[model samples]
Target: METPALEVQLQTLPSSPGVYQYYDKNQKILYVGKAKNLKKRVTSYFTKRHDSHRIGVMVKKIKEIKHIVVESETDALLLENNLIKKHQPRFNVMLKDDKTYPWICIKNERFPRVFPTRKLVKDGSEYYGPFTSFKTVNTLLDLIKGLYKLRTCNYDLSEEKIRNGKYKVCLEYHLGNCKGPCEAKQPEAEYNSNIEAIRQIVKGNFKESLQQFREQMKQHAEKMEFEDAQRIKNKIDVLENYQAKSTVVNPKITNVDVFSIVSDEGYGYVNFLQLSHGAIIRSHTIEMKKKLDETDEELLELAITEIRQRFSSKSKEIYVPFKVDAGEDVKVTIPKLGDKKKIVELSQRNAKYYRQERFKQMKIVDPDRHVKRIMAQMKEDLRLQVAPTHIECFDNSNIQGTNPVAACVVFKNGKPSKKDYRKFNIKTVEGPDDFASMEEVVFRRYKRLLNEGEDLPQLVIVDGGKGQLSSGVKALEALGLRGKIAIIGIAKRLEEIFYPGDSIPLYLDKKSETLKIIQQLRNEAHRFGITFHRNKRSKSALNTELEEISGIGEKTVIELLKQFRSVKRIKEASEKELAEVIGVSKAAIIYKYYKSKKET
Candidate 1:
C-alpha cells in the first residue's frame, strides 16, 4: 500500500536509468533497486502483483520512494549496489559474512616498504589485495623477501642525505638481507627494477620477471660467467615454482574475473576468481542471505558489482556460469566448454564447499536445530508418516558359520545413541544364515521393546537387499507390528535402498543427508557385530584349546588363559614364567605336556 505522498513522489520520477530506494513509514530503507526507467519501474511495483511473498510484504510496507537519476543503466547498477551495501536494505540480498580481508601494501616512499595490511590508505602507495587469507598474504611477502634484497629502514633515501653520509650500513646489509639503500650502497635503479618485478609478480604476471632473469642468465652464460648464470637460473626457478602453485588455468586467460554461484533455500554462496595470465590470483566466496526469494541471476549480478568494486577489478571481460547483466561496458561470457568453463566449474565447487563448511559450523553452533532439520529431511526423503526420531539398524556377522552374531545400533534424533546399542548371539539362526539372523534379531529387539512397554523405533534398517528386508518384514508381521514401523534394507553395492514391499529400490543422491545417516547406521551396525563376533570366536577357540589339555581343569584353565591370554602363549611360556603366573603345580603340568608334545 503506497502512501499518498509516495504516489505523488513516484509520479514525478524520470523515465531514465537510475536507482530507486523504498522506505518504510519510519523513513528507513526497506529496499533498493535499479531500473532502466525509474518512473516505469517504481510504478510497476504498485500496478503489478508480486508472486514472491517476501516481495509482497516489502511492497505493503513501503511508505515513501526516493530516486537517484543516473547517466546510464551501468551507473544505476553501481549506485544500487553501493546503496545496498551501505544501508543494507531489509529487502536486499545482503552478504552475511562481510569482513575485510588483508592485503599486501607497498608504501609510497623513496624505497617502498612492503608488508601485509588490512587498511586501504589512499596515498601514492600500491595495495595488492583483499586476499582471502592472511596466510596467503604472508606467503607472498615471504617469497618476495626471499627473492629480493630490499631495505627495511624508514630513512629518506634522498641524494643530499646519502652524499652527506647521514646513514650507515646496518646488520641487514652485513647479513646480505638488504642492499643498504639508506647508505647508497645499493643503486636506486637496481632496487627500483626489483620493485617493478615484484609489482608484476604480485599482479599474477610472472612473464616480466622471468623474461628479465632469463635474459640476464643468457648474457652471463654467453660471457662464461657460469656462477652468475646459475644464480639467475635459481631465481628463475623460484619464480616459476611459485607461479605454478598459484596458477589454476591456462596462462593465456589473463586479466579476467570469473564468478559462480550456488544457492539453497535461505542463502546464496557466490565465489569469485580473478585470473591474470591464466593463473588464479584471487579467489573468495561471499555468502548472501536471501530476502525476496531472489533468483541466482539477481544475486550473482549484485555480487559481481560489489566484488568488482571491492577488489578494484577493471577487467573488460568477465566469465560467469550463466548470462548476466554486468553493464554493457563489461563483456559477460557464459563459457560452454574448454578452460574457461572449467574455471567457472571450479568456482562453483568452491562455493559449494564453502556452503557445506558453513553448514557444518552451524551444526556445531546449534546442534538441536541441526538435528531437527536432519530429521525433517530424512522424513521427507524416506517418505515416512512421522520423523524417525529413533532409528534402529540391524547387521549380522558370521565367520564360516562360526560364532555368528548380530548387532543393533540405535540412533536418536539423527545421532548415535551408543548406550542403546545391543549385540545378540545367533540363538535361533545357524550355519551362516544372514536372512534368519536378521529376522531373529529384528523380532527379538522389537518384541522385547513391546513387552517392556518401551518405545519402538520409528524406522528399522536391515543391512542387506530385498531378502533381508523381507525377513525383517516377516518378523514384524509375527509380532502383529507390520505397517506400524517403517522398515527398509540397504545394499552396499550401488547403495540401493529397498522398501519392505517395493521391488524397485530408491537410490538416494549420494550427497544427501538421508544417505549419509543411513550409511552411518549401516557401518556402525557392521562394526559392532564384527567386534562381538571376533570376541566370541576368540573365546570359543581359547576354551576348546585349553580344555583339550588333560590336567587343566576349567578354573586352572581360566586363570592360565587370563594370565597368558592364549593357549599358544601359555605353551610357549618358560617353566619359571608359568610358575610365577599360575603356581608351580599347574605350571609343571603345562610345561611338561608341551615339552613332551613338542618332542613327539
Candidate 2:
C-alpha cells in the first residue's frame, strides 16, 4: 500500500546516520526514529511485514517522509529525542513521567547559597540533583545544616558591602546556626571549603568529608580543643549514619548506573539506580506505553539516554540485563554474576513493584480499565479465541460411594457468580466414578441451558486431570460444542492445565493471575460439591430412620420431622405430642416402633 511518492522517497533515502520523521497527509507528525543506516531502516518498514498491527497502521498512514542527516549516531539519537519531545508524535515511545522534581542549586555569588528548587535557572550556579522527593532534599539540607554553619539569609555578602559595615550579625549567628558570613565574621576560604564538602555530600560521596572531619577532630584533640573535637565527632556520626542507609552494595562498585527493565504487552518499566561509591543516591522507575510494540532493547536504550539527560547523570559505565545501543561514549555491561548482577536484579524488582503498584491504583481509580486488561491477559494466557468472561467449573464430590453428587460453580469476569452455581444429584452414574459423573453433569448443565435458551459460558473448566477433561470434551462433542466453547482441565497435584487434544499440559507461572483464577475456580467447585455431598448424606440418614416405620410414609415422616425438628426430639416426645403433629394412628406406630427398638 505504499504510495508512488513514498516509494520513490524510500529508494532515494541516504545510507547515513540520521533521524527520520514520518508525517501523515495533513503534515501531522506520527512517529520519530533514529538509525545508523537511514536507507536500510526506512526500507525495511515498507519491505517487511510488521508483527505489530499498530506499527503497520502507522506505516500505512505515512504520507510524507522527512530526514535530518546527522554527523554521527549519537547526534542522530539526540536529534530524535528532541524532535519527539517537540512534536509529541502520536506513535513515539510515550514516557509517563511529568512531575517537576526538586534540584539542589548552589548560587553563583561571593557567599554561595545552597537550597532546593523545582525550577532550573540557567546561570553560573551549579545544580546537583533533581531528586524524586522533597523529603530527600530536606534530609540532605538538614544533614548539611547540622554539619556546617552556612548563612541562610538572602542578603548580598559582597566585599564592598562588608567593608562599608552595611550588615550586622543576626540571631542565627547568636544561635551558632550561621558563622555570620554577612558581617565577614566567617572567612571566605572557610565557607568555600564547607561548600565544597556540601557538594561532595550531595553527590552521595562522603569519604572526603569524613576524612577531613576526622583530621580536624584529631588536630582539635591534640590542641586540647575537646569541645570542638566532640562536635566534629558528632558530625562524623551523622554523615556515617546517612551513608550507611544509602550504600546498597560493595564499596568497590562505585560511580556506576544500574538500569533494568520489566515489561508487559502494553507497557515497559525501566528502573534506574544511580550509584555513587556503591551508594544508591537516587532511584527512579519510568513507565512507557508501547508504540509500534518496540522491543525491550529499543525501549531500554531510548530510556537510558533520556533518563541520563533528565537526571544529568555523567556515569561512563552502566550495568544492564542485556546489551543495548547507548552510543559510543557509554560502556554497557551485562552483569552475569556477583554484586553487579544483584544490582541489576534489584532494579528489575523495583520496576516490578512499580508495575504492581500502578495496576493496583488503576484497579481502584478505573475498574473498567482494570477488568479489560485482566480479560485481555486471560485470553492470551489461556489461548482462547476470546476472553473467558463467563466460565463454569465442575467438580464431583462423594464419600465412600454414598450421596454421590457434582457441583458446578460459575465465574464471570474472573469473579465468582454464586447465584448461578448448580448442584447435580448423580442419578445415572453410580459409585465414585469421577469421569462418568463429570461427563454426566457437563452434559446435563449445557443441555438444560440449551433447552431453556440460556447463554452458555465462554469456557468450561473440569477439576481433574486428562481423564476428567476427556470426559468433559466427549460431552461437548456429543452436544456439538467442542470447538464453539473452550474447555480445560486443572490437575490439583501439579496445578497443570490440559487442553482438549494436547497430551502435554501447560504449566503457568505460580504467581500468575491466570493460574490464581483457575485455582480459585477449582477450589470453589470442590467446596460447593463437598458441602452438597455432606448435606445429602445427612438428609438420607434422616429419611431412612423415619421412612422405615411400619405405617409412616415419606410424607408422614417429613411432616413429623418438620414438627419435631430431629429424630431424637421425636423419640423424646410423648405420643400425645406426636398425635398433635402427625396423626393418632401414625404417631402410635412411630412411638411404639421407637420404644421396641430402644428395648432391644
Candidate 3:
C-alpha cells in the first residue's frame, strides 16, 4: 500500500515528554505546544477533525513537525512558555502581559528584606513565587508580615554599621512590629531563625509556623497572660485559614497526575490534569478516534501513556477513574474517597465538557461526520444487519371511512427524500380498515420496485404498533421479502417501536438520535398521507356534486370540472359558457339541471 507523505513522520514521533512546534511552508513558525507524548499530540493534529477553524487552518498550513523532548512535564511547560515568548508563534495565545508578574524576593543581603518585586535578579536571593497577579503577591506578603515581623528598610545591618553607631531604634521598634535589627538590638542568630521559619511558610509548608505559634500560645497561657495568649490564638487562626485556602486539595496528595475518559460511539475524549503541591498547574483534553471499538480501560491506558510521555511526567503516582496497567515504574491509584477521588471526578467532568464542546463544534463544522456517527449509533440501537441508509415509512390516512389513502415517505441517509415519496389510493381495502390499507400500500410499494428492478429499501417502517406491523409483515411475506428487508412499526402513543411477532415494544431513550430520526420519519409519513387524503376527499366531493345532475355522466362531470374548476363556478356559468367546455348538448343538460334546482 502507498503511504501518505506525512504518515512516516507521524508514525515515528517519540512517545516521550516534549514541546512540539509547527511551521508553515515558508519556514515561518505558526504555533508552539508542549506534549508528554510527541507522536500522540502531533498525530492528533492530522487524525482528528478540529472544531476550531483557526486550529484547522493552522494544521492545514503545517509543513513540518519539529519537537524537543524534555525530562518532565514542568520542563515541557517551561520550554513551551519560553518558545512562545521567544518565537511569538502566530497560533499561540498572545499574552498581552509584558509587565513581569510579581515574585516574593527575599533580598540577598544582611538582614534580608522580604518584599514583592516584578524583576528577578540572580544575586543569590531566594525567590518564592511568580504570582499570576499582584494581589496574590500582596496577600502572601501580608500573611508573612502578620505571622513574623521582617524588616521593611533597605539598610544593611552589618557588624561595622552597628559598631559605628550610625543608626538608632526606629518607629518600627517602638511599635513592636520589628525587633530593631538595624541597631543590633536583635541577635543575628535569633533573626536568622525567624527568617528560616519564614522560608518554610513561603515554600507552602505551614506546619512549622503553626507549631511554633501553638507553643507560644501555651507558654503565655501558663504565665496567665490571657491577652498575649489570645493574640497568639488569633495569629494561629489566620495561618490555619490561609493554609486551608492555599491547599485546595490535600497537601499530602502532591505531585500527581489525574486522568479521566468520556466517549461516544465514534470517538473518545480524555482529560489530563497535572498537579503540583495540591494545585492544578496544567490541564489538557485530547480527542481520539476509535477505530477498533476500544473499551474505556484500553482507551484510558493508551491516553495515560501518550499524555504522560508527551508531558514527560515524572510523578511516581497517578489518580485515575479506574484501575489500569500504567507500567511497573508508576503506581496507578483509583481514588475512592477524599480529595484524591474528588480530583478524579473533576477530571471526568472536564472530559465530559470537552466532549460536549467538540460535539457542538462538529455539528456545525463537519455535519457529515455527525450524521455518520448517528447512523452507526442507530444501526446498533435498532439491531439491524446494516444501517437504514434508504428507509421507507408507511402511514395510512383514513378519515371517517371516506377517501381512504396511504403515504410512503422515503428517507435516504437519515433525511427525507421527497422526490422518492409515494402516495397510494386504497383500492382493495374496505372503509376505515387501517391494517388492510397498510398491507395494500406496503405490498404495492415493494412489488412495483421489484417488478421494475429498482432498489428496495434497507428498512420499512409502519406508523403504528403490533397490529399494523403484522399487516406490513404479511404483505412483505406475500411478496417474498419478509426477511429480505428489515421492518418495524412506531405507535403514536408513548412513541414505542414494535417489531413483527413481538408482543413488547422497544422504547428507545427520549433523547436518543435513533428515536429522533424514527419520530421524524413517522411524522413525515403522517403529514404526507394526510395531505394526499384531503386532496382526494376534496376532488371526490366536487366530482360527486356535478355527477348528481340529471343525464350528467362521469366523463361529462370531469369535462365541466376541467374547465370551470368547481361546482359553484359551473352553476354560475351561462349555457353558452358551459358549452365552451363540454359542447352544446351536454352544456344544456348541466345548465337546465341547475336552473330547475334553483327554481325549486
Candidate 4:
C-alpha cells in the first residue's frame, strides 16, 4: 500500500550504496536503513512480504522515501548510524548510550598540555578515553605527573615569547613540580621525550617507559650513583605496579577492541572492553533502544560505529561476538576459543549483568514496577502461594499492665494503607500479658472480617518474637485460618522473621527490599499502637485527678475537661474563667483544689 508520492520517490532512488529513510504521512521518519544497492533495498519493502509484524506495520505507514547517496558501503553504514542516532527513527536501532564520559586530552600546542575533559574540542588535539570514572583519569594523571617534569601554567609558551622573557618561573618551578618550560629552563627535546613516554603510558604501554628507566638506573648504579638509581628503580616499580593492576588478559592481545551485546525485546545492552598491550583499561556498557525488531547483528553493528566514534577508539582490529560490517579497513574477528573467546565471554557477562542492574533500577524508579517487585519478593520470602498485595501487621502496646491496647496497620502493595488501620482496646487480656493481648486482637480482627464478609489479608505480621507469634497462630487456629493466612513474627533486636510451627527464623539481608517493607510495617504498627495507648493513658490520668477533687462529679469533670482540655489549663484558669465553663460553685471547688495542691 505504498502512496503515490512514495512510489515516485522510490523510482528515482539511485542504484548506489547509500542510506534510505522512510517517512510517515506527517513527514516523520519511520526507519533509517543502509544498503549496498539503494534501489533494490528500498524496493524490497514493497515487493516482498516481511515476516516480522513490526516491519509489516511500519511499511504500511510509509508516505515518502528519502535517500542520501554515498561513495561506498562503509560510508553508508556510518551515515545510517549517525542518522539513527540523530533522528531516532521508529524503525531504526537507536543506541541510547550517549552519556558524556571523561577523556584525557593531549592539547595540540607548542608545549602540549594534557588534562581530563568531558568535551571534544576538535582542535587537532588527541583525546584518549571516555573513561568510566574520573578517579581512573585522575590516577593516570597523577602517575604521569610523578614521572614527568611538565609545565602547570597556561602561558602561551611560544619560542619568541620565551626568548623575550615575557613570563617568570612560578612556585611550581621552585617546588620541583615543573621544569619551568615557560621560561625555557627545560630543553624542548627533554620535555618532548617525557610527553612521548606519557603517551605510551596512557595507551597502556609500559615497556618503552620501563626500559628507558631501567637503563638509566643501570647506568647510574654502574657510576656509583646509588640515590639516582634508587629513584629510577622506584619510578619503574610504580609503572609496573600500575600496569599489573590494569592488565586482565594475555600480553599478546594488544590494540584490540572487544564488544559483546545482550539484547531483549525492547533494548540491547552492549559491553565494550578496550585492550592495549593485553590490559583492559576501559570497560563500558551502552544501552540501545530497539525501534524495529532489529536483530542482534544489526543492533550491534550500529553500536560498534557509535561507540568507536564517541570514545575516539582507533583500534584496527575488533573482537566481537559475531561478524560485523565496520568497514573493510577494520579487521573484525569472531573468536572461537582461547583468551580472545574468554574475553568475549567476559564482555557478554558484563552486558548481561548491566542489563539486570538496569532493569532492577528501572523497577525501583517506576512506582508500579516497584510495588509489583516488592509484593512478589514478599510472597517468596514469606513462602506464600500468592503475592501479599494486602498485608496487616499487629503490635501490642502496654505500659506496666495499664492502658493495654493493640494496633493493626494495613499495607496494600508494599505501601501503608493508613485509612484501613484498626485499633483495639485490650478487653479480654488483663495486666501486662502481651501474648494474650496479641491473641485477643488477632481473633477480633479476623472474626469481624469473616462476619462482614470482607476479604482477608494475604499476609499477617506480628511485631514480636516467637511467644507473641505463637499466640497469634493460636488465634488463627481458633478461627479455622491457621493455614489459610500466612503469618510471621519479627524480633526487635535482630529483625528475625519467624514462621508458625518453625522455630528457625528467616534472616533477610540487611539491604533487602522485603526486609525494608517488613520493618516499615512493624514500625508503623508500633507507632500507631503507642499513640493510641498514650491517648488512653493521658485520659485515664486526667479523669483520676479530677475524681480526686471532693464533690466534683463525673458530669462536672467531663464539662471542665471538655471546656479546658487539660488539668494544667484548668489549673491556670481564673475562678471567673472556670465559672464561665462550669457552674460558679463547682468552679470555686476546682480552683481551690488546684491552689492548695500547688501550695503543698
Q: Top model by TM-score, which number?
A: 2
Worst 10 residues of 3 by lDDT: 92-101
Report the lDDT tens digits of candidate 3 across residue range 300-373. Answer: 76677667755557889999988876765678898889889889998899988887888788889998887788
RMSD of 3: 12.7
lDDT of 1 by residue, 1-600 (tens): 677887788778889999999988899999999988989988998989876668899999988888888999899889898888789888888787678889888889888888889998999899988788999998888888877888887888888999899999999899989988887788888988999989988998888888998999999999999999999899888888998898569967989999999876467999999998889999989999889878899899999999998888999999998889899799999999999889999999999999899889988999886777678668868988888999999999987888889999999998899999999998976588989988998999989999999999899999999999999999999999998999999999999999977899999989888999999999999999999999898778866777777777788877877888778898899999999977898889889988998999
TM-score of each: 0.66, 0.89, 0.50, 0.60
**Tens digits of per-residue lDDT for model 4, 1-600:** 787887888888899999998889899999999998999999999999775568899988998888899999889989988887789777777667556789898888877888999988988998888788899999999999888877867788999999999999999999988989788899889888988999998988888999999999999999999999999999998888888888569989998999999875567899999999889989989898776667899888888888888778889999998878988778999999999999999999999899889878887788686566567557656678788999999999998778999999999987888999999999987699999999999999999999999999989999999999999999999999988999999999998999888989999878666888999999999999999999899878976888888888888877887888888898899999999988799989999999998899
Show pairs that collide, candidate 4: none
RMSD of 2: 3.3
Instruction: Please list the C-alpha lDDT of all candidates, in the order they appear.
Output: 0.89, 0.91, 0.82, 0.88
Residue pairs with clashing backbones, model 1: 250-278, 251-277
Candidate 2 lDDT over residue span 1-600, tens digit each: 899999899999999999999999999999999999999998898989776679999998999999999999889878888898788899999999978899999999987989999988888899988898999999999999999999888998889999999999989999999999788898999999999999999988899999999999999999999999999999999999988888568789888888999876678999999998878999999999888778899999889988998998889999999999888888899999998998999999999999999999998999888777777768878888888889999999988988899999999998999999999998898688999999999999999999999989999999999999999999999999989999999999999999988999999989888889999999999999999999899789977788777677878877877887888999999999999988898888988999998899
**What is the full ranking by lDDT, best candidate first?**
2, 1, 4, 3
RMSD of each: 8.4, 3.3, 12.7, 12.9
TM for candidate 2 is: 0.89
Model 1 poorest 10 in a row by lDDT: 542-551
Q: Which candidate is the best by lDDT?
A: 2
Q: Which ten residues in a row have the lowest lDDT in candidate 2?
A: 371-380
